[model samples]
Target: MITYQLSKPVEHGGHTYQNLSFRAPETGDLIAAEQFKGQISQTVAMLAMMSDVPLPAFKRVPLRELYQIMELTKDFLGNALATTGD
Candidate 1:
């Protein structure tokens, strides 16, 4: 398991946020990016569903789209890590 810590509080609108974090489990031999992406996407989708938000109309969701989402997630994680570097 890969764990990262926040060095500073996340702030918005002049207020500090707490407990904001991300975690990714590293498998034994393979870092399957697609699997991570799918996990994130499904989690988001589930949250949206719980909140009664309508999902987008995609004729066919492809693996490429999932990969793209994963890449975006990786970039986001990288930025967060950089901001809270040790």
Candidate 2:
């Protein structure tokens, strides 16, 4: 799991979260996130699924932090693709 410390914490459902830990996304996560139409939305959905976090909670994340989170997700996908070709 990759744990990311949020620069700005997120509050949701009466609780605050300081960090998000993402497990490597499985094929099910990719299928699930496909309900979202755009690439960005899909990526965010995948992140939520991998982190076991509710999607609504992502609304409170700071913009800068969101970009970093996207980058992390991209890195995971990139690494997975790189290995699968071999």
Candidate 3:
């Protein structure tokens, strides 16, 4: 299990929303948490594909870059959710 924290409020179309946050059992830096990060990264990518948001340009970027983009996406989605009152 991986833990994620929302850095911004999620809001969409004048509504608020919330996103998932959990603590993982493994202990390591984000870079070292490959499995956990991979799961989150995949989830983010899927969501981006299904949403209005444009996907990232590079598909083979490093995990660190993916992690950063995922965090931003998570925050954006969280804010959208918050705004939608989800």
Candidate 4:
């Protein structure tokens, strides 16, 4: 597993969180990514499924941070680039 520490903690509503970790993709993760067509949903789901994080956690992340994390892990086994916008 590869672990990444967020530059700063993220705040959503009244909660704050830090750090994210994910492992290399397995066959199941790939299959799930294939099943989702929406770019954002698919990306977040892929990340959540591959990582220790839950889906709600990704939803709480700021867009810039989310993009950075996804880009940083783009070539990672479980983290595919599924962006629809720049």
In terms of TM-score, the best-performing candidate is 2
Residue 68 lDDT in model 3? Answer: 64
Error of 3 at 30 (Å): 24
- Highest lDDT: which candidate? 2
Better of 2 and 3 by TM-score: 2
Off by over 4 Å in 3: 1-38, 47-58, 79-86
Residue runs of model 4 more than 4 Å from their true location after superposition: 7-16, 77-86
* Model 2, global lDDT: 0.78
What lDDT tens digits, residue by residue, belong to model 3 across residues 1-86? 23333345345455433332332212222323233234555454444343323334223334564576566556444432222211
RMSD per candidate (Å) reads 14.3, 4.7, 14.4, 4.3
| For model 2, the run of ten residues with the poorest summed lDDT | 77-86
Runs with alpha carbons beyond 4 Å of true place in candidate 2? 79-86
Worst 10 residues of 3 by lDDT: 24-33
Could you give candidate 1's per-residue lDDT for residues 1-86 as a string of tens digits? Answer: 22222344444445443322323423321232222245445433432232222334111223454344345446434432222212
Q: How well does candidate 3 match the true structure, expressed as C-alpha RMSD?
A: 14.4
Each model's lDDT comes to 0.33, 0.78, 0.39, 0.69
